[model samples]
Target: MDLQQMRYVVAVAETRNFTRAAERCFVVQSSLSHRIAGLERELGVRLFARSSRRVDLTDAGAAFLVGARECLAAADRAVADAAAATGVVRGRLAVGVIVTTAAVDVPELLQRYRARHPDVHVVLRPGHSAELAAAIRNGDLDIAFLGLPESERPSGVESVVLDHDKHVLVVQAEHRLAGASQVALREITEETFVDFAHGSPGRAQSDEAFAAAGLVREVAYEAGAGELMTRLIARGLGVALLPSAFIRPLAADNPELALVPVVDGPRRIEWLAWSRFNPSPATRAMLDVLGVVRHA
Candidate 1:
C-alpha cells in the first residue's frame, strides 16, 4: 500500500527471516511482522509462508514480489533522478564483486567514484560470480563485477567487458608438468585437481574446457580463494586451473609454485553488469565514471 510497506516486503523476501529483515530495514521485528500482516490483509493474499525455521514465499507471494521489486526500483529511480536534476548524485550504491578476480581495479575505481560523488554511499559485497549475478538479478545489488563467458551472460542485465584474463595451470615447482610452457587439458586429466567449488564460475569454465576435450578431472580439494588454492598447490596438494593474473603476483613470492598456460582453456571475461531496467542515477554515474555507457 505504501513505499515503506513495499520495502518491508522486499527486505523480508530477500532475507527470508522476519528478524533479519527487520534488522536490515532498521525496524523492530514486531513492527515488521504487524505491517506485513496488514499488507497481506489489505491485498487479500498471503505474501509469505511463515515457519519456525525459515520463511518461504507462496505462489502468490512470488507473483507479488516481482511487481514489488519493480515498484521499489521505480521509486528509487524517481528520487535519484530528482537528485540528478539538482546536480547532485546521492544514494546508496550496492556493488557486488567476484571474489577471485584480479582484472578489476576495484579499490582505485571506488576511490575515484567516492571523490566524484562524495554524498553517495557505496557498499561492496564480495562473492563468487554466480552468487553476484544472482544478487544483481534479485535487485539486492545495483551493479556487479562478474566473470562470465562472453556468450552466456545472465539475462535481464546489461554488461560491458572490463578485462580478460586466461586460466593457467598451477603446480608445485617439482611437479612433472611444471616445466611445460603450455599443457593440454587431456595431459592433466589424471592429475589431482584443486579448484573452486563446483558451481563457481571459474570451476564451471574449467569443467567445461575439460569436458570439451573429452576428459574428466578428479577434484581432490576445493577452495573459495585463489590464495588458499595457491597455498594448497604449494603444499603439493594438487594442480589447479586459475586465473593467470591472480597467480602471477603470488607466484613471484613463492618459488615453489609454477604457472603454466592452459593450451585451450577458457578465458575469464570480467564484466560490469547492471539491470537493463531503469538504473538508478547513482548506478549510472558510477558506470559513466567507469567509462561504460548503457545502451537503450
Candidate 2:
C-alpha cells in the first residue's frame, strides 16, 4: 500500500527469511512480520508461507513481488526526480558500456563528467553491447555505449555516433607474418584465426569486416572477452582481430604480441544510446557533457 510496505515485501521475497529480511530492512523481526501481516490483510491474500525454519512465497505472493518491486523502484525514481527539480542535477545515473571501451580512456571521460556534475552519482556497468542494449531497454541503464548497427536501432531509443574504432589483427611476435606493416584481410583467411564469440559486439564487427573482404577465416579459437582474446594470442593459440584500443595496453606491456593493422577490416562506429522518452536531468547532463547530443 505504501513505499515502506513495498520495500518490506521486496526484501522478504529476496531474502526468504523474516529475520534476515528484517535485518536487511533495518527493522526488528516482529515489526517486519507485522508489516507483512498488514500488507496481506490489505491485499486479502497471504504474501508468504512462514514457518519456524524457513519461508516461501505463495503463488499470489510471487506475482505481487514483481509489482511491489516496480512500485518501490518507481518511488525511488520519484524521489530522485524531486531532488533534480531544484535546478541542480543530483541523482543516480546508471551507465552501461562495453568492456572494450574501458580500455580506451572511458575513466577519463567519467572523471570529466563527474567533475562537472559532482552531485550526480554515475554507476558504470560493463558488459557486451547486446547486454547493454537490453539493460537500457529495461530501464536498468540510463545510457549506454554500444557498437549498434546503424540499421538496427531499437524503437523509442535515440543514438549518436561517438567515434570510429578501427579493428586490427593481433598475433604473437614470433609468428611469420607479425613483421608485416599491414596485412590484408585475405592474407589471414587461410591462417588460423582467434575469433570473438558469436553475438558479441566485437564479433559482429569482425564478421562484417571479413564479409566485406570476402574472406572466410578458419576460427582456431573463440574467446569471451577481449582480455581473454589477448591472453590466448599471447600464449600463441592463434591470431584475433579486435579494436585497436583493446591492444594499446597489451602492446605496451607485452613485447611478444604484435597488433598488426587490418588493411580491409570494417571500422566499428561507437554510439551513445538512450531512451527518447522523458529523461532525468542527471541523464541529460551526462549526454551533454559526453558530446552525444547533437545541435538541431
Candidate 3:
C-alpha cells in the first residue's frame, strides 16, 4: 500500500531472497518480511511462494510486479523532473554495451556526463550485440552501444549509427597465411577457425560473409568472449576474423599473432540505441550528452 512496501516487494522479487533483499534495501530482514506480509494481506494476493532454500514469485506476483515497476518508474521520474527544473539531473542511468564496442569513447563520454550531472548514478555492463539491443527495447537499460552487421539494426529502438568497420583475419605467426598482406575469404575457408558462438551477431558477420560467397568454414573452437577468442588465435588453436580495432592492439602486444586484412571480409556497424517509448529523465540527459559527444 506504500512506496516503501513496493520497494521491499521489488527487491525481494529481484534477489529472490528475503535476507539479501533486506541487505540491498538497508533494512533488517525481520522488518522487510513483516512489511511484505502486510503488503500481501492488503493486496489479497500471495506474492511469493517461500521455502527454506528458495523463493519464487507466484503467478499473481508476476502480474503485480508489472504494474509495480511502472509505478516505481513514474515516481522516480517525478522526482527527477523536479530536480531537472532546478537544473539538476538525479536518477539512475544503466548503460549496456557490446563486449567489443569500437566506436565512440565510452569512458570519456561517461566522464563528461558525470562532470555535467554529478547527481546521476551511472552503471555500465557488457553484453553481446543482440542482448544489449534487447535490454534497450525492454526498458531494462537506459541506452546501449551495439555492433551489428551493416545490413541490420536493432528493432523497436531509436538508434544512431556511430561508425562502420571491417574485419581482419587473425592468425598465429606459425600459420601459413600469417605473412600475407591480405587474403580473400575463399582462401581461408579450409583453415580451422575460432569463432564466436553460432548465430551471435559477432559470429553472424563472418558467417554471412562465407554464406554469401557460397563457402563453408570449419570452426574448431567457439569462444564465448572476445578475449578468449583472441587468446585462442594467438595460441594457434585456430584463426579468427575479428573487428580491426579490437584485434589490432592485441596483435601488437603478441608478436606471435598476426592480423591480416580480409580483403573480402564482412563489415560491422556500431550503433547507439535507446528506448523509443517513454524514456526516463536520466536517459534523456545521457542522450543529450551523447549528442554533444557525437558532434565533438
Best by TM-score: 3
TM-score of 1: 0.77
1-296 in candidate 2: lDDT tens per residue? 78898888888889888888899989998998898899899999998998988899999999999888778767777877887777667878999878677323678888888888898888989887888877887788888877643334444467776666677788998998888899888888877778667777667777777786677878878776777777788898889877786667767798878878877775776778886667777788887787664443
Please tell me which model should have the higher TM-score, number 1 or number 2. Answer: 2
Per-residue lDDT for 174-197 in model 1, tens only?
998889979888788899999888
- Candidate 2 — worst ten consecutive residues by lDDT sum? 148-157
Stretches > 4 Å off in candidate 1: 1-75
Error of 2 at 159 (Å): 1.0
Score every model by TM-score: 0.77, 0.88, 0.94
lDDT of each: 0.86, 0.79, 0.88
RMSD of each: 3.9, 2.6, 2.3
Q: Count the backbone clashes (under 3 Å) in each candidate.
A: 0, 0, 0
Better-scoring candidate (lDDT), 1 or 2: 1
Arranged by TM-score, best first: 3, 2, 1
Q: Report the lDDT of model 2 for residue 101.
A: 71
* Residue-level error in angstroms, candidate 2, position 51: 5.6
- Over 24-137, each residue of candidate 3 has an lDDT whose tens digit, in order, gives 999999999999999999989899999999999999999989899999988988999899888889999999978778787789999999999999999998888888888888
